[model samples]
Target chain A: EAGVTQFPSHSVIEKGQTVTLRCDPISGHDNLYWYRRVMGKEIKFLLHFVKESKQDESGMPNNRFLAERTGGTYSTLKVQPAELEDSGVYFCASSPGGDSPLHFGNGTRLTVT
Target chain B: SQQGEEDPQALSIQEGENATMNCSYKTSINNLQWYRQNSGRGLVHLILIRSNEREKHSGRLRVTLDTSKKSSSLLITASRAADTASYFCATRDPGAGSYQLTFGKGTKLSVIP
Candidate 1:
């Protein structure tokens, strides 16, 4: 089976510009998650989606960042007025729920100049 | 904030040697997992050990969890150059209804072939 896939493997934007990253989870997976890793830092959870509804968003950093999973098959993360700190690799993962292991995408590398 | 912190931060080993990485986390957890990421690639799930599980083995990978110490260790036997990558530990809170994972700063392993 195909693994999770992310779009625009690399993105570069101005510091004040807006950027959006997309993720497509594996088929039949009911759980989707977003995570980001800043340079030389730990990968941190951003949010989680169970089908079309968000299960947890407490990890979202600020109001400027928004994530949505419209049809529950894919997810998008948007960073408005992106800051330098928003430059990082954004990863998407999906699972079958329960104790299943997550399958991750190659991630979108966002570079804010 | 990151919940788990990997010890050594980095490691180097010769081919056919074994590599061990340790992770220490705070707070109670339901399970602990390990992941690997090659350069410019996405994370791949290595293994998952539940709170009730003391040890798990998958091929050359062995994982041990100690809930009382809030720590875990990942051992890669007969390491090869292909095993060179960053290894990370993630944990899910026992009380959290969502399967959100908190990750640690990974240990970058360099296998000298």
Candidate 2:
């Protein structure tokens, strides 16, 4: 089975610019999630999508960040007016269900100067 | 503060040896999972052990959970050089209306052939 795939493995942009990260999960997976890891920090949960609807978004960092999962097959995370702290590796993951194990993508390394 | 913490931030072992890493969480968790990332890339699901289960194994990977202690461990037996990667432990706290996960600072493992 195909694992999760991410695009634009590496990204670099100046502060205040916007960046979008994409993730395509495995087929038939109902649970899609977003996570990020800062340098020397633990990975963190960002949000979760059950199908086309968001089940939980408490993990979102701030208002400038937006996420969407059209048709629930893939997901995109957009950070507007990105700050220096936004620089990190953003990962997307999907699972079969709430109890299923998650499969993650290689992640998109975003560099906000 | 990090919700989860892993001891022995780094580990080194020879081929045929066993690599063991420990993780501790502050909150009560519904489940704990282990994942491995190579070269800071994507993560691969290693194993999952629910709160009710004390132990689980997949191939050479063994996971043990202790709810009373709020800790977990991952043991990789017969280590190979290919096993070099950063291993992380994530915990899902089944809090009121909160289903997000908390991850620990990963343990970097190096298996020398």
Candidate 3:
């Protein structure tokens, strides 16, 4: 089966601009998650989705960040009015369910200047 | 907050040698997992070791978990140049209902040919 896939492997935007990153999980996977790694920092969890319903979003950084999973399939992470600090790699992952290990995508590298 | 910290932030070894990375966590975990990420790429799950298990192996990878010390180690035997990447250890809290994972800073390994 194909692994999780993310689009626009790299993105460059100016501060205050809006950027959207997309992720398509493996077929039949119901659990989707978002994560990010800033320069010199460990990868941090952003949020999670279980079949279009947010399972957890406590890790979201702020109100400017939003995520959506429509039709219980693919997911999108949007950063409005992006800031210089928002420049980093945004990763998306998926799993079948329960405690299964996650499969990740190549991630989208966003550079906000 | 970061749950785990990897030892020896970076390592370099020649091919056919062994590379070991250690991770120390602050709390109890349901399971510990190792992942490898090539530069500019997403992470790939290497293996998972439960709290109760002591050791597990997959191909050239060997993982050891020591609950008593709240630490874990990953060893790649007969390493090859292709194994060059950053290796990270992630943990899932036993009491956390959410499946989000807490990751360590990671160890960057350079395998020379």
Candidate 4:
């Protein structure tokens, strides 16, 4: 089976712009997660979705970021008025269920200058 | 503060040698997982060890968890040059709730040919 796939492996945009990253999870996987890694930092969880409902979103950094998994098949993370601090790698992962190993995508590297 | 911290920020060894990495976490966790990421690639799940389990092995990889100490170790025997990448330890802490995973900074391992 194909692994999780992320769109636009790398994106460069000016600060204050809007960017959207997409992720397609593995087939039959109902659990999806979003994480990010800033420069020289550990990967941090952003949010999680169990099907179409969000199970956790406490990791979201600010109101400028929004994530949605409509219909429980794929996910998209949108950052409005992106800031310089938003430059990092955004990773999306999927798992069979709770307590299962996650399968990740190549990640979308966002560079907001 | 981050929940998990990986010791030895970087490691280098000759092929055919053994490589070991350690991770320490604060608070109780349901399970801990090890992941590998090659340059410019997504993370790949290496192995997972539950709090109740002490040690587990997969081919050349060996993982040991000490819940009492709140630490874990990953051992890769007969390492190959292809193994050069970053190894991260992620913990599923019950305190975090919702099956969220907290990741360590990771150990960048370089296996010399």
Name the lDDT value of residue A44 in candidate 3. 95
Best-performing candidate as measured by lDDT: 4
Listed in order, each prediction's TM-score against the native is: 0.97, 0.95, 0.98, 0.98
Native contacts retained by model 3, as a fraction? 0.78
What digit string (tens of lDDT, one per residue) describes model 1 on residues B6-108? 9879999999999999999998998999999999999999999999999999999999999998999999999999999999999999787689888999999
Once model 4 is optimally superposed onto the true structure by TM-score, how far is the C-alpha of residue B61 displaced, in angstroms? 0.8
Q: For model 2, how does the per-residue alpha-carbon lDDT over A1-113 read when each residue is reduced to its tens digit?
A: 99899988999999999898999999999889999999988898889999988989988999999999999899999999899999999999998886687888999999999
**If ranked by TM-score, best first, what sequence of candidates would result?**
4, 3, 1, 2
Estimate the overall C-alpha local distance difference test score of candidate 2. 0.89
lDDT of 3: 0.94
Rank order by DockQ, top first?
Answer: 4, 1, 3, 2
Q: Candidate 3 — which pairs collide?
A: none
User: Comparing 1 and 3 by TM-score, which wins?
Assistant: 3
Interface RMSD of each: 0.9, 1.6, 0.9, 0.8
lDDT of each: 0.93, 0.89, 0.94, 0.95
Task: State which candidate, 1 or 4, has the greater DockQ.
Answer: 4
DockQ of 1: 0.85
Q: Write the per-residue lDDT of candidate 3 for residues A27-65, one digit (tens) a residue.
A: 999999999999899999999999999999989999999
> What would the per-residue lDDT of candidate 4 be over residues A1-113, giving only the tens digit for each residue?
98999998999999999999999999999999999999999999999999999999999999999999999999999999899999999999999997889999999999999
* Residue A55 of model 2, lDDT score: 89
Residue pairs clashing, model 2: none
lDDT of each residue in A25-92, candidate 1, tens digit only: 99999999999999998898989999999999988999999999998788999999899999899999
Count of clashing residue pairs in every prediction: 0, 0, 0, 0
